[model samples]
Target: MSDNLEDLKNNHQDFSKGSLDSNEEKNPYVLFGRWFDEAIASGELEVNACVISTVSVDLQPSARIVYLKEMVDNSFVFYTNYSSQKGKEIAINPKASMLFFWPKNERQVRIEGEVVKLPEAISDAYFESRPLQSKLGAWASHQSDELVDSSEIHNRMAYYSDKFGDVVPRPAHWGGYALMPQCIEFWQGRPSRLHDRIVFTSFEGTWKIHRKNP
Candidate 1:
């Protein structure tokens, strides 16, 4: 193992004690929102970042960091290139997992669920709200493709810049995916490596909350 890997393996972090009250159990979405609010208030770097994991048809898993754009109606929403590898993977198999870890709060949340394409109107509205540079870059770059040179990317940017000018339209190959979580597991740190784990699993129109072994 590398020196850094050895060092990381030997290192340990003790979690603070925090309990999720049982009475506060209506929706897991609300609990996640509350935890997200705390993470935001703690001022962690890129607090909105989440690790999205997707599996291909062959069951190979891939993960990438993506910024969480919104959580609406119990679904986590993030946008990316619909033609990217992840997009293609989801196209073939629409199941995905998401992880949110807040080092400062010693909290981690894992979610597993099915992915669904958002409405085109939702994508268009979000696309129009983006900064012009981002819009142009989105149109210019082909995600998950091999690039020969930086100059090619620059030329593509220039080409798109000239083609679309100021008002760049959202490409059909780019939009959002909403993960409808079937299970959400919340972890809180405690002393001596012992931790609190609470999981909510969705059933027929209801969620069953249970405590998990730490």
Candidate 2:
């Protein structure tokens, strides 16, 4: 590879000028919602897309982009097939991280937490809320598994289409996951390179707040 390519690959995105003042009176959850609302108002694409990072039993790491569907009570929720790579990773190691960035607002949020499966009732409720086509696709796709041809998927969909023309039942393996945050960090970008970072952490029954250098 060229030296310029290597240098570019190693470069980091500099964020300057943002300040974090935890004096907002509201909790981190509320603050997050406020920022998210602003992001939506700013017309950012895929405001709900977040980077989910998981670790395997062998200590390897993997990550992917997934939609953030709900913020229930105090946790964030999303759904997927329980048999996928991420699913297996969480099965063995429940520690995970989620990152959200809104370029238009020059804001970023990072969450590190423990992963826990939502109650069956919650999962079932979200599953039932999905569109019939999504439900059918869920039943048709094997998720992270390999497929020999596109025909297999189409065939499966056809079979499901004939089997249930109007409505499709949610699969037991496809459901929702709740990520309970142990630490949450909010970042805002500034003019030069000095950015603001505020982090909130939970311990026992109390919460602690801190500021970190950019």
Candidate 3:
């Protein structure tokens, strides 16, 4: 290593939290649930947060952080404005990917799949569960759109608050999207930079598992 980067290059951590065995859970969802539970129990902040990537029709890629709300029908679920940049991109190209990293445990998961809109009833139910202010925000924010000033959002929030009074309805432009994953990969960090990687892919309604070099 160069002398200028010698100290930085020498800094490393020995990841000995856990290991991935071939005999472990075969279903990716099962494995994900186990790891997610452990993350929560370990006091990881924002454990449900993940980065989602989308590509527009022009082939430009964009990524943003979103919270994973639930796992339903073998898919990962999250909510957002249907008119947002990511939503528009997904409309043109349904293919998307999600990534979850837990630095404390030195683990990561990658999910790739096509996204689909959830039914209106499901969105309604989840919306009702949100706090009052958040419900108001859903109606106030014209997500991904240009705003003249921050005060515009406050004005809209005030308008919606007075209009809805106590019961705020979910906006027609807001709902949930489900990512039906075709491939899922799990990675575990280890000492000496020799990491463990396992990938599961879907084929003919069945999932096939494979180990990957890392």
Best by lDDT: 3
Q: Which residue runs does candidate 3 get wrong by more than 4 Å?
A: 1-11
For model 2, the superposed segments whose C-alpha errors exceed 4 Å read 1-18
TM-score of 2: 0.90
Q: Of the candidates numbered 2 and 3, which has the greater lDDT value? A: 3
Considering only N, C-alpha and C atoms within 3 Å, which residue pairs clash in candidate 3? none
What's the candidate order when arranged by decreasing TM-score? 1, 3, 2
Q: Per-residue lDDT of 108-195 in model 2, one digit per residue for the tens?
A: 9999999898889988888888888898898899999999899999999899989988877778888888899999999999756678
Please give, for residues 1-214, the per-residue lDDT of candidate 3 as tens digits: 6776877767778787888975698888899999998888888899999999999999999999999997879899999999999999999999999999988788999999999999899999999999999999999999999998999999999999999998999999999999999999999988877888999999999899998998
TM-score for all models, in order of appearance: 0.94, 0.90, 0.93
lDDT of each: 0.89, 0.88, 0.93
Please estimate how well model 1 matches the true structure, expressed as its whole-model Cα lDDT. 0.89
lDDT of 1 by residue, 27-88 (tens): 78888889999998888789889999999888899999998897757799999999999999
Q: Residue 81 deviation, candidate 2, in Å?
A: 0.5
Cα RMSD of all models vs. native, in order, equals 1.5, 2.5, 2.8
- Residue 135, model 1: lDDT of 94
| Candidate 3 lDDT score relative to the true structure | 0.93
